[model samples]
Target: MTTYPKQALLLALAAATVAAGLTATAAPAVARPAATAVPRLDWKPCATPGGPAAQECAVLPVPLDYDDPDGRQIHVAVSRVLSDRPAARRGTLAVIPGGPGGSGVQRLAQKGAALQRELAGAYDLVAFDPRGVGASTTARCGLAPEDRYLTSLRSWPGPDGEITDNTARSRRTAEACARNGGPELRSFTTANQVRDLDRLREALGERRLSAWGTSYGAYVAAQYAQKFPRRTDRWVLDSTGDPDPQRVARGWLANMSRGADERFPDFAAWAAHPDRDRDGLRLAARPEEVEPLVVALAARLDREPRPSTTPGVPLTGNGLRQAVQNALYGDTAFPGLARLVTTAQDPAGTPALPPELAQPLRDEDAAVMIGVICNDAAWPHASADAYRSAVRKDRARYPLTAGMPVNVLPCSFWKTAPEDAPTRITDRGPSNILMVQSRRDPATPLFGALEMREALGGRARMVTVEQGGHGLYLGNGNACGDRAVTDFLTTGRRPTEDTHCAN
Candidate 1:
């Protein structure tokens, strides 16, 4: 379910640097060593067209591989909007974006105005695109268009729960990445991103910084807090996943089955509501009937695929299933899913494919996503027999997901193994982190957020909002939930105990 922006501005660097044939300076093994001397950034007007007029952009040169610090170099694109009132400014608040491939600069443009209004001039808003993202240095896997489709990349099992096609696709994808993705792709790890952020801290010339990290970014922020305990202030982890180093992304993908099942009820209730009748979006007479109707519709589509608005691309059962998973993320998406469902069930209706499914993803976006997970941790290269058995069980247990969450991925055939282990999130950091997670998030559910909470222990206080969505603050229209996080950020006040915003 992790997707990247398709049309982000790809600003051109004056020159993408390449350091040739020199042995990198190795750091001391006693403590975390500096990757390389932080490069001084020359800030200028950002090239991203839609960003705030006040925002400034910069390029940061980081080692292609930290262990080979002086070797090849790549640029990380960063942006910042200074405090409107310098006299009232407290410090810098870094905005960490989600998706191993999410763009921080773009997010700043989208949220910068609200963030400025929310905090007044308390702090400067700063963000950056991690390696292999946005205007930063990028790599491509040279994957064929078919392999880049959203459905192909998501590892959805074939018809009748068969995974032969998925298995072949996985191998093909990994092979493509290995053949075309060089050291640039291999360096896209969560650990490296943490390192890059620290280097950014040095460039900003700050001893400490506050942060608001969402989704996968939360993991990076947490890791930063763990690695440089004294450097972080007032950290916010919104909609984070489990930090179990052993499972990592694999555990995250596997858990989505349960998450989807939990959040589907919200969609069902919405779809069955009388309010939807006016819009011709109501799917069933009762919430209980919605699930069966969706399930049956998907099964029927498996037998006779429906033509979509996208030429040559038909809506299959898995397409319906993916739509269900995507819709559960937020209420804003419910109408689309309802409409798509109605369209599929209608004899003369033609379905419109979601933008994500309309075409292939950019190679760099796919590279970063696949690289981070594959290079961060190892995946099981289980036999086809083993996979078939597991997929059968997961499908039976969580039919809405249709075993896609637990199916094979390119990680199973990734070229490079992780040089270091995944960072195990622990409670050994300053007690300034506040976590806000929805009670039922399809992407990062309550069960997983609890795992992050437990891992952080005394260092964090969690606010569970009684809402349904992927993000908590600024996501669901839950004022109480938003206020809780805002109060903590603006005034350093918390509920004193892990509490729930039942309203």
Candidate 2:
């Protein structure tokens, strides 16, 4: 999930900008032709608290709808930390953030120091909040508080793995978005994000842009490369999912089942380790026993819900399951999950709910998450019976996820069809693209990344890190994987072929 403080920072920056009289500009009546000159950005000193003091910020105005450039306009918050050694600067490197909900401005702040040290003054680091995200133009679906919690929004099935509540919630969410999201929410999409990136390129006066895109950002990067091949320079796609145009978001969701299974063993081994005994976190004596212990604990919770630290919000079977899924994203989160599981299993102990489960997401946050996924593609019009059957099958096969991966979501009940067909990624782009992936990412697994590699074909080379986690480069990735990506970005050189990085 996207960090709440980062989201708040973006919103705070937007408010600060408005207070300083930097208002959004109105688009002209006649749509400007693509060949027309793009407006230059007005950069100023705008840094977030505890962020890099050197960071500069600006708001770029782009049409709310690219198809109607003369139509309503919205401001996209952009930030940059220039290369200290300008004499050695190659070009701008855009740090695209993951999440249909991630704030790019915040990502730049988080990774700025590490990137500067790694690249050795090769480029200026830049990033931006997409239309409906962060400090960018905002929109809301005004969803009810109960429906805005992560567990509700994620479509976890009932105690018996039934999806009856899922269908009803899906319909309610879709309706709320359609009723209150307005045009700005409708504008949140992959294609528009690609168009907005081009606008950023034009505004920055760069003929080409190099980028580091991770997870969902990888999908946007791939789309940008495909649409504007010559405009790309040294593209890096980290931990990508399949870019199947037809399946799009649906395919990404379904792939989570495999991802969860692939990542579970790593967590199991950690939880059952001899060292965990000293920490008082051992789940079982053997790695194999950990899975059954968890499964049985969940079943027991389903029968009799345990009270959590939060009032009126008890820990249910699905709550533990959701916590497991989130924890699998990175190894650093393993100990917390182990502790939660241990607490829940104790009859006298109360499990403290994770922040995501304890509180309802901000309405705008929920809007962006649902808006991007649903607007990306058309979901199958599956009936209640279909969802129930799928849930039963998935739960039987992938107990770790508890069938949530394949269950119905708001996309199933989305009122509007996609504005445009999903972009089909191909090898037609420049061969400067390099991909780095983990062998067992809980969110974007190896198999899906391989599919993305296959789709890119001759245009891309991949480095598979023999590690288990969600993100690669600069995060959970091994030293070998990190060095390969750093080498590619700083020197414009790639491995001769797809390579593996031993843990």
Candidate 3:
């Protein structure tokens, strides 16, 4: 799950999704990584153009395969910014990015200054690019350009819930990965990511690390805490997913429909507001009319796709649905999504496709994204008729998603089973985990977050924000929610009980 300041290609929830999800129950016993020497980090000044001015970068060597500790090593790019007040500094805080594709170094650059300001001198901020991400060891499947497009990555079904095309594409994509990805690609699982995190901790010489993991990163952090309970301090899981081992990412995807339904009211209210009339962004005169209006417009688009700014790519019903799904991640996205609908609604007007839809993703970017989720858990190999029936039922039940959530994905035909079984997130860890979630998250819905909370038991205390969005802390949450996270990170004071923060 990816949501942020709405940058191009930062559309993991839409353009590209991730490899795994957290589950509430147990899976087969996990094969822990054998003890290995922590590689040294030779830090040097490496700041991006618009990124943190004082950020330093380093490369950490982690085993390509966790089972063979002395085997091949993959480089994980790491970045760090020391706490300004060394005297008051407590320890290190890792800023874990959301997607299996999200770069932690980039996330640190995006929020480091703000985080540093909020954190004061509590800890040194650190982040990293997991294996196969930016500035790290990478792999690819040499997928066709068409397969890398946001529309294709999401595997959105036909307007009428048809999956024949989706099934064929998913099968072909899986075959390409198996044929070209080689063994290295298969190693890109959530389990390895968690192991890589512990190795990062060892390189830092930190006995216990604090972390703020958002969206998919939250799941990574949770797994880390699960595997190495004694190694975490004041952990915060932001916008977490359900930890059901059987479903994992599939469960996370399926839950998005509920998330969309829960969150759409906020959008409807905004789009129906009288103020929006001034900008010609109003969709309907009333909140109730907004949903129906969107549904009807989508149905109309299904009959005839409209030309878009991008040559050769028309704005279809699924494209509109994707845009809507993406816009739900943040309120700032509302205007653009509204304008898209407005332009498409005009018979003579041409709409502009979002970045993911406008162009195809890079081969490596697409490979890792498809690799992680598909490698995390086993998907149903049920007959095609069964999948079709499920999609039809889903489309009817959750019109906003049009069955995309439950629809087929590249994982449905994936060649590899999870190398390591999924981890069951239990309450066995320290009670330092603080989960802050949106009441209406479009990606990780509140219901899923509740399951995560239940899985963590007393180990986690959640702060539910009275808002609608994917990310919570520092991005979409209100002051109350932000303060909760900041306070937990700095002073280690968690709420006595689960509490709600008013928007």
lDDT tens digits, residue span 374-394, model 2: 998999999899988998999
Cα shift from native, residue 154, model 3 (Å): 0.9
**Pairing residues by index, what is the TM-score of model 2?**
0.93
lDDT of 2 at 342: 94
Q: What C-alpha root-mean-square deviation, in Å, does candidate 1 show against the real structure?
A: 6.6
**What is the Å distance of residue 483 in model 3 from its true position?**
0.7
Residue pairs in clash, model 3: 19-372, 19-373, 22-242, 22-243, 22-244, 23-243, 23-244, 24-243, 24-244
- Predicted structure 3, TM vs. truth: 0.94
Leading candidate by lDDT: 3
Each candidate's lDDT (Cα)? 0.78, 0.81, 0.82
Model 1 has how many clashing residue pairs?
Answer: 0
Kindly report which residue stretches of model 3 are placed more than 4 angstroms away from their true locations once superposed.
1-35
Q: Candidate 3: global Cα-lDDT?
A: 0.82
- lDDT, model 2: 0.81
Model 2: residues >4 Å from true position, as ranges? 1-37
Cα lDDT tens digits, model 1, 232-252, are 989999888888999987887
Ranking by TM-score: 3, 2, 1
Q: Residue 330 CA error for candidate 1 (Å)?
A: 0.9
Q: Count the backbone clashes (under 3 Å) in each candidate.
A: 0, 0, 9
For residues 1-503, what per-residue lDDT tens digits would candidate 3 score against the true structure? 33532322222362432211110011112232334765777888877666668899887877888778888766778889999888889999998887767777777877888887899978999988776676677779889988877778887788688899989999999999999998878988889998888998999999999999888888999999999999999899999889899998888888888889999999999999999989999988999998888888888888999989999999988889888988998988899889998898888899998876677767777887888888989988878788888889988988998888888888889988788889999999788999999988888889999999999999989999998898888888899999999999989999999999998
